[model samples]
Target: MVGRKKRTTICDKELQKEDLISNLHEPLISEILLRLSTKDAVRTSLLSKRWRYLWQTVPGLDLALYDFLNINFSNIDAFFKFVERFFDSHRESWIRKLRLYLGYRHHICGLKSWIDAVTRPKIQHLDVNYYSSDEIPVSIYTCETLVHLRLEWVSLPNTEFVSLPCLKIMHLKRIRFTSDTTLEKLISGSPVLEDLKLFGCSNHNAIQLRSHTLKKIDMDMDHSSGFVIDAPLLQCLKTKIASTKDFQIISSGFPAKLDIDLQWRRRRPLERPPKKVIRDILADIRRVSDLVITSDILKEFFLYSKSRTVRQFRNLSRLHARFAICDIEMLPALLESCTKLESLIMVI
Candidate 1:
């Protein structure tokens, strides 16, 4: 009778317990919370008192206001004001990143104060994208704690800002500088910098790079222009160009490996090897571990330098090409020169 009574009690509790746990629980993952907009974060206050303060301490703060959504411009100042208020009141100094991108050019003036307020010593990562006729504020450029920075479609003159000591990665897209030395000076200043990217900018004149700690560099060199690489610690390099004759690569030392992508214009005739071009790049690259050449470019390089010593092809592991509406001429000499080639890839 006692055993049967215990079994009967368990059955009765199952139906009662199911109803108690039916409510939906909030998600614990942080990514879902980050996707919510500032407005959505504010709305969370209605959930409970605990959630009210939670949004204030969130790691990421994005303050890019959509002007189209707001009917009146008068409310713009108020939005910026509220954001400034949040940074001031938040006590915790451990904010991981604070990203502020004010899209509209009209509100750039208001950013001066907001930038100064948000760049606390505690903030580790900061990204700002804005357009201004005035110069970049010196205080913004000299941020000691910033590790990654991106300046797009902006201008920074030479005389004002000199260096960024703590920057590790930088992306300058369509950025214009006043002079050639200005860009070089800024690059050399980042002593601990690792990666640098330049896309569609003026003054592609021979750039002298002197980074002791750089690792990767990707540059789309301007045709009819030349640039030099002098980084002692460079490991990977990717360069693409149209006029191979005009492009020159000067390296302090060749990367451990090199991957070249070339696009030949139909108008240029098949001509002799550009001795100046080949010599400039060879001066820096002491050894090329792997060479990936497009089919068209491989033909060009072979045509320019015929029967060159395959013995100098030291440490080369692969020779690959991609053919596009072009016949692959049998160049046994080209393959023979790569004495150490281990594999070849051909994609038609």
Candidate 2:
């Protein structure tokens, strides 16, 4: 009887501990559920009656169907159905963040419906990666509460008006824009935007980016014609342009860091920018503290560094460059231009 009594006492303590934990505030429990993946969070319903409906009120949802592309028709239908049901079951109208990594493109209708359903007024962050060919819904641009948006392998819709009052960070990868003015319009609409990244986006005939609150602009455009920047408050600028006539910084913003990669093909070596043009380009970014130039751009700078008209980069403190065989011969002249350079990184 004594041994049985001790065992019973231990079991009672365990039960009491669990009861205390189960009685935690609903917001605290929702936070715990938010940290879990959608599938795992929903599975918690099986843990206890209290947790059964807790996931329904969680404000964040991260859903990734890894095998979505390889699944059969029946499985795909069932997967989408489950997603639909999950959204339908959510009790809260406002989602803090929603991320979806979809593998297939055939479900455009379903994808559109899902995005429309989740892009509520209170949704702050939305990230969607669709590997298939599909244009992003125009509704995304109107999400007034969106703070951060990232879209991969999507085409931008041609809309007359775009107003994202709260958007600050935007990242576009392999995106297709309808017209040259589409990008300009998009940037103009986001009054408080700070950071923008464009990676391999199409319809880059001549992009004129003008923003009052922008701080950082990063572009990797291989097929771009030209870019004209007019952001007065910009601080960081990075670009990888394939054409010699690709980009020019027209702003007096004076970015602190500049990373430029000019891809000059050897077959058409004469396509390199003229010495005067290279010098003028360097003059624009002379205020940059940290500067990174690829081998192609370094070759142009080396050719022009011998000229007396080349200005010194007084503010440049860090210099990073890839040294080609020709660049090694003009290394001394290049170093002379960066009078305040404190760090040098050379890659062969």
Question: Who wins the TM-score comparison?
Answer: 2
lDDT string, candidate 2, 129-233, tens digits: 887656777888788899999988777878889999999999988877777888888899999999999988865478788899999999987478788889899
Cα lDDT tens digits, model 1, 47-97, are 655565566656556655663237323566776677667767654554546
Instruction: Give candidate 1 misplaced runs (Cα > 4 Å).
Output: 1-53, 63-95, 100-107, 159-163, 221-225, 242-252, 263-286, 309-315, 318-337, 343-348
Q: TM-score of every model?
A: 0.68, 0.78
- The runs of at least 3 residues in candidate 2 whose Cα sits more than 4 Å from the true structure, single-residue gaps closed, are 1-26, 32-56, 67-74, 104-106, 265-277, 303-311, 321-337, 343-348
